[model samples]
Target: MTSRTLLRLAMAGAVVAGSLTALSVPAQAGNAPKTVPVRLLALNDFHGNLEPPTGSSGRMVDENGNTVNAGGAVYVAAHMKALRDANTIEVAQGDLIGASPLISAAFHDEPSVDFLGKIGVQVSAVGNHEFDEGYAELRRIMFGGCHPVDGCSPAGPWKGAKYDYVGANVLFKNPGEKTDVTQSLSANPQVKTLLSDWGVPALPPVSIKWMNGVPIGFIGLVTQTTPNIVTAEGIKDLKFVDEVKAANVASKILKLFGVRAQVVLVHEGDQVTPNQSPDACSAIPGAGNRIATQVDPEIDMVLSGHSHQAYLCRVKDPAGQDRLYSQGGSFGRVITQVDMQVDTKTRDIVRSSVVADNHVVTRDVDPDSDTVTFMDFWRDKISAVANKPVGRISADITNVGTATGESPLGDLIADGQLAATKTGGNAQIALMNPGGVRAPLTYLTSPASEGDGVVTYGEAFTVQPFNNLMQAVTLTGAQLKTLLEQQFPGGPNNQPFAKILQPSANLSYTYSRSAAWGSKISNIKIDGVPVTDTQSIRVAANNFLVGGGDAFAAFKEGTDVWSGPLDIDAFVAYLGQNNPIAPPATTRITAVD
Candidate 1:
């Protein structure tokens, strides 16, 4: 028998023996209590905010409707310590890294991983951002090694993560399947053989922790829509299965191992109503609810991320059992504390006894000294590159969208991309994915202290942290129109919701909110002239969009692709050329009722 099979058999036998012992020694007069209390301290979508986030990202609304500053690695540490006990198990749903601020992103997010390890994160589900740099880079992060390109940082050689990253839904593509592999492992025969092993998951599917002699199992799953959102080149060799199916399968395996208390750490969540109490459910309709309700009844609870909303809810499982479902807000702004009692005899959680709450990582608490020192070390190392003034902004260019789904910051970024590619690719227009605009660029002086209106490299880096390369492609006006149409739901690509693309200053279009999907976009213009369907035009966008990310498959039909500088480099250069830039008009895209 295989080693895995042997291990399963051994565990089954042990469970059987334990059951017999329990039956024989029942009804003792002074035996210990039958149940043990366990605490789970959970957070998700941290995104490496070592320092307190600035502007709206750093603050959360309280139950009293007051905005309060929250979230710093130090404060998060403090809160975790204050709330945890001997029976506590700290865990995360996903997005522990990627799209981070300069302090952590500068070193390929090693500092963030180190912080999570130091704070005792035992296991985490892999987020879509974990694959931002591709699966190979993620593997390097998990297994420990210096970045092949950047080498070791001043802190010393990396020791990898102390925690386990589990992803039951991530699987390797079969041989002979089409892929967009940037670095293929196909040439290595041994590696290929290993990948072909039967029923092998890309990452560990489940992690089991024994507490008070009862095993609690955690099954990890990323969103099945991961491929549509992340860069195709990075995850080209992986296939994401349905979240519900993967969770059920993993739960069955955990059951075979005699694990009865199971929790799903899924990297998908729903948006709760704005200004709702952090601890209130009030969840809007989304995939998180579906997964919570549809997963195997054996799964006891589900913690989620990716949507970056804070909520503590009790969703009904397939068997009509109310199970705790919660998500912590992104950027360490919130923590979900779950308390439950597990029955020692059955190794199962008491569903009715579970209690969960979302706590804001408020700044009022004394920060953890160790975390402060850790943040300082990384800050000092990146100060030279991060603190330099890149440009100036006359006012705040926030990513908060208007009614038409356009934002001032998105306009600025699209304009910058267009300028960068105008001469080289002869580009007439540019478009940017709204999701890529991570943060707002405020005119006020930041913690970097570059002075009011002065934007530092670090501030700019926080706004566009992905470092995607810019590319200009040739497309027919007809194709461009189709691209805009794809932004809404129910096209050939079947977008789940509207994701309006930010347009360059020279391009403008109008769409009807009540019109059919293919017929929504109208009045397409470039340079005050209506675009002819047959006319060829050069468009600029990040490589991620050109690779058909965000369901904009029409971009893949472009020709004459001309690569340019990194998106950050282009934005920085544009800011320098246009000093004291004001927020652009948000009238580029018009919507009609």
Candidate 2:
């Protein structure tokens, strides 16, 4: 951390005493506890997958290949308890609910919230997905007495999470006003009034602890981009305030309360590289964007998430001063630990910097019996429908990426789109986003290897969980070329909203690695013919893309659009009609110059 970023949070000589002298408590512990040590276990985005899934790291590999299990709620509970024997705090970033298995989302966020509460998560921010059903649903899940959503009857284990869910920037139509509401921490009047108008109850911002004689405050924030990324239906009329501005507002408020040593627990992050580089943003891990660096310097430690990446970085703030910043990778794969030293007398942070290290939640240690029990209980309920085979892959649909090409799995999905859209051959090319392929075809049970196994309707829905219907549209050959080039020159980064839409197997193209944004793609072909950059091709894709979702504005330019309903259901129907269809002998998506 740089010198200027300290908020000039200078130590009170009488309060803090000596800096490093008091910080090295471990050395003089024999003299009876002089300085106290506190641990903060922060995590985020556990989307209600109670049980560990297959083919996942489930653990983090350190600098070496050694593997370690990262997390499980029960273990998280145990670890937090063990650490708190000193002065530890347990916290989460956000997205603890929504997009969860049907088991949890069915209950809105109640199950996840209650689950967090049980696991000892003391505080959290509101993730984008938390608003999947809007503020009313959030109220029902967080504060309302009963779980209004389904399967809540059993209430199995989530009982509800034990944590403070904070959303400093989540506001109503009213400005600078507190809505009539109830949450863990205290809130301003504007927040209270807004919640009342929306019929949604919200918790307060910045939970604080007065340890020794010093007060430490924690401010929670969700990404300002929530409204743009979430479904249009979920966030209607709601405003996602600017993250930096909201944080600054809160810091000033905390200042009024005479609180210092502030930490911002936000759900925003930046791209990261290990060991600090041009991309580094302070001592926090799991690198991402410059949000940590760009925010005000009053924040001592910024714990961030939402990118599901792994990085540990430290960056200098606007004043060329440094602050401690870190983020853990998504999934319960890795647990990040940041250690801070506080002065004993004043409870003021004397010599504060941080160490961002990670540990894998490995199965090697005993899985907390309660967590295992709770997880297994829900696993059975969710897997009953989730694990059921949906449809048969008549071919070896695989996404195993080789050099410079697409996978067989990518082709099969593309083919599914084309087949769904080709009522009368209206479309020739099918496109999909690589991120949408949730699971791969099981080697033996898939459609390709027939052993009296048939594709079930359930299996197909699993592949297309987004429920995007297959649609066909016509574009001029020239306009189509522009669309393909757009993916290249821009890639996913050139345009902040860009999403890589993987083409179906029926298409082939060669894109250069060196090409600039909006121009990388060069040669393209479909069905044994070279495609002109400006030439159009009839295209098939899920409703999400065809409607300009993920910022694919080109699809909107198509002259004709036709819907074939949900693609997954179409896959199931196709399997029933074509029981023995074979996988294409050649992989469809390829590269060329």
Candidate 3:
């Protein structure tokens, strides 16, 4: 017999022997069938943190109840290398690039994608932030190319991500009506053609990897509410479908390909109970839990992100079988390790043999030398821009919200937006979404030693990183009141949570916490004058809010929209003008019990 034929017969005999043992028949010595052991190291919401994150973003509470500084690309690479074997696969749940630190964002997140590829991230789901620059930009990142506008600064001839980005739910909009492509992508005819491919997903829905002759399928899904949170212009030609439906369909497709072991990498996640250990599964109510319980039974595991919480869960599937569901914390603070056994004959995971744990990426270990070199290269490239002093702060203006949901940093951003648009757009007031304020402006000097109270351009960029364009729109007093009402849950717009907008100093309003949704808001005033329902008002805000993002639907009712400078540029100009800026009071939105 040929050698290959002999090997096949031996494998068949082993399977037969294993089957006989299951039926209570004794198996011959040394003829027992073996299962392939696979290891998965999963990360989520990395947000291009090539260096160790600062403040609370870089810290994690350990099992011992001690807070330890954690997370950096170098340490992540080291931990991954130490835990990986020949049968291992590294994956990310999503938010790997967008809303990144200045070093990564300045280069359009190319460095972060490059780092992910170098560390062998075989696959990742597309997070909503992946659409921050629009689908055309994401396509460029995936397929490799120079930036259309920036043209590959700091590094020439950029190569795209080495990993596959999958998003089953991200589908092209129907082309029956023409959709205008973003100006950044107008030069790329390929993207226009791709967007016209109706009924097709914007990205690959499933990624299949082979380990030890067993094919494992990964289905990726983003949150259905992505449109409400992301900039509307970037995703005008795309729609996000239900996660459960997409997962099941992808699972069926994998099955047709003779793949039985399946996993879902979704960008929707739930939070665990406060103060719980990293592996605790006391999950709070969220969409991710619903998805975990509803996905197809053939799917063996669900790895999730977007909410950026760390938790390990074993939710019961429809078949009453338990499956692993997990999320690693954001900013690389945690890494989830999943180990499972796959039956070679059935090509299915032994669900009972699955074990998962969340490991804190503490800085105690030695950094990976290769990743350090890579980080240094980018740091050098971005230093000149990053270290330049843009403003000064008398004290830390943090993004932490108060009892009324207003944040000091949010107030500062609103003031800046108003300043930028007041003259050009005839704007009277500005409102800032709390979510847009990413980080705090600290008065202390940074590692670069730029001097206390001196805020660098990098620090300011980190605070407002999305680069949304400022806009002024005319709204009647009645519509402005409706806008304020939409901040609460159960309001006309049905927002999931209370999103109190940070108002410029010229605006103030009071809300009753115990009142009915629409009735909660009252005492609205602008510039010390009570607003009348019939009065016309010109309000300033970023394009995101006026475009109805974050469920603020009332902002869409504005007329005579006037676009201004980028939000970041406005903020920088405000900082430069208001040297040694003090933290704004968080008293703009008053809450009554």
Candidate 2, poorest ten consecutive residues by summed lDDT: 1-10
Q: For candidate 1, lDDT tens digit of each residue in 1-593?
A: 01221112234233243221111223423677888899999989999898899889999976566789999999999999999899988899999999999889989999999999999898899999999999999988887789999999788898788787888888777644432120122223432343344234667777777666677789999999888888898888789989998888778766655678999999999988898888888778599999999999999999999998888888899888999888988999998889999987777999988999888999999999998898888888999999999999898899999999999999999999999998888889999999999999988898777899999999999999998999999999999999999999988897988999999999999999999989999999999899999999999999999999999999999999999999999999999999989999999999997
The total of clashing pairs for model 3 equals 1
RMSD of every prediction? 5.4, 8.6, 7.9
| Per-model TM-score versus the true fold | 0.92, 0.74, 0.90
Q: Which candidate number would show the highest lDDT if scored against the true structure?
A: 1
For candidate 1, what is the lDDT?
0.86
Candidate 1 segments exceeding 4 Å error: 1-30, 175-199
Q: Order of candidates by lDDT, top first? A: 1, 3, 2
- TM value for model 2: 0.74
| Tens-digit per-residue lDDT, 1-593, candidate 2 | 12111111233111132121111212334565445565677777776544442233244554455555565566665554444544666777887775554445444546556666766666777777677567766655554445444444456433333455677677664444444323311243443344344432233555565444455667778877665445555456577777776676666555544565677888877654443321134333322345676667766667787775555656676777666666666556556676776655444454344566655455556566676677667656555565554444455555454455455555567777777777764889888765456444443553223343444333444344455568888887666655665554344423353344667666776665666656656556788688765665789887656655555667778767787767666666665566554654334434444
Candidate 1: clashing pairs of residues? none
